[model samples]
Target: MSQIQGWAAQQAGQPLVRSSFDLGPLGAEEVEVAVDYCGICHSDLSMIANEWGMSRFPFVPGHEVIGRVLALGEQAKGLRVGQRVGIGWTAGSCMHCRQCLSGHQNLCAELEATIGGHHGGFADKVRAHWAWTIPLPDGIDLPSAGPLLCGGITVLKPFLAYNIGPTARVGVVGIGGLGHMAVKFAKAWGCEVTAFTSTAAKADEARSFGAHHVVSSRDANAIQAIAGSLDLLLVTVNVSLDWGALLGTLAPRGRMHVVGAVLEPIPVPAFALIVTEREVSGSPTGSPVDIATLLDFATRHDVRPQVEMFPMDQVNAALKHLADGKARYRIVLEGAKG
Candidate 1:
């Protein structure tokens, strides 16, 4: 490929402009995909603004990618040209590392994020190691399915990791992008699901997403009403909240698992753990097998994200919509038109 056309920001907080760059020769283990659609995640905005201080100039940002395989290297196996596939937060990892060997490749020391140092799915085409270029299952909705690659896996990782069961009582704090998916996954898993949000307007919508209950995340009384009743509390909001009150809602031995990237340190009392054996933990997106499992589960359950769509060329407008918090649940960018 001579030049891969893409939308990129030349500097921090600038609107993405038409840009193209060469990846040169594709590696022996790589696969190139013709991007059809990509989801706009909040983290994408962070990367675009260099908020994490890791943004490289001419940065391309779109990790929740859905497209068809266009090219494959000689060593790329188990995938065919024209096969529909998806790529998430990770594009590649050191295949020889212990984490990769043990099927925990997301934790590999040198994980290559799609938009980190490399180009991402905001392009007409994107490339990843064959392993990270996941095949889309049959009968799945291709447009809205992009978020499943990134945010879906993010919320589902806790259920898979903690071995959450049907009998467990779960709480999802936040009802936007990630939390909504969490509610659906929890309800589909047959767990009793409670969704917490500060906004009263989202309550009914949360329940529509399969939440069994809705409560005020800002109300201390609301948090206390369910005190010690939850088996798992999944925090999906990046903003800080009543940490103690939220933690107090967990049952003995229950876990407070965080998927959101909260910037400040959360203060947890020592006795909070010692007395009830409560735990706090966090995880990024999942591994390849984990992603495949998420896709399969979503397919069987008819779980799909509610999304607003924009033509890929209107990326700046879409970005502003998301930045202004007008995106109802999530947003997807379609491939550029002919």
Candidate 2:
């Protein structure tokens, strides 16, 4: 076993503390990564707070990871020592499942998430299964690539899956970590991007992310202004919303793709969809292939997150910043030596 330093919650509702943990012997299909940076995602906060009720004690919670490959097992291939790499929410998936067999590993029932089912990148080093680790682009730095592992891919994959292109008039609801990325991706794709936020103060920030137009979602007049104008709506907020408000903004045969929180249970008016044949769906994280592609696209287009870096020891302050929406766009924890 290899000994390393990490910050983990000793118990539920407790703050993360520095501790020494063991990394078991590397498996034949595994590679050791020296974690350089890790994003402080909402999921990490949720898990540490035990919001989902499945968090393990002393949990090391961080899925958006970017690091250098320090070592490789005998069977690990296509990756070299000292190469920059990244790992997202998923670590393993049952190869026999239909989704996994079909190449949609994120949909596999037996998939293991980085922070939940396995030890994640909050530690100094993480042993990732080779098949799940992705190579990072040369143009992106480790800190910039950290959030791309999860937040970037989450927004980018749905656009690729739904075939959204130049002609699509896209609406991104919310302007936080996920919504901000949605704006950059949608604009880079040549879509007419409109950002919807309840708070008027976020309008300028939303526009800075590439949204051509920003509207106060709470204002009925503003909401009515865009009725039947959008071809696609990407709801990026976890809070409950009136589905009719969004469905009304869509043009005929429009689609709404959700990839936000797990606890959201919005009441959708069926008539909103039945009348115009609009569709509503959800997306999880992307497949390894999708992530690799997204990394290239992000670098090619300069689509990067505005992140605030914090030391791992300042995790509690970082969490508070994220919760208060004080961070510019994304929050990352550095100082973890993969």
Clash totals for all candidate models: 0, 2
Model 2 pairs in collision? 34-338, 35-338
The runs of at least 3 residues in candidate 2 whose Cα sits more than 4 Å from the true structure, single-residue gaps closed, are 262-264, 336-338
Cα lDDT computed for each candidate against the true fold: 0.94, 0.85
For residues 20-43, what per-residue lDDT tens digits would candidate 1 score against the true structure? 798899899999999999999999
How does each model score on TM-score? 0.99, 0.96
Residue 80's lDDT within candidate 1 is 100
Instruction: Please give the TM-score that candidate 1 achieves against the real structure.
Output: 0.99
Q: Pick the candidate with the highest lDDT.
A: 1
Best by TM-score: 1
Per-residue error (Å), model 2, residue 208: 1.2
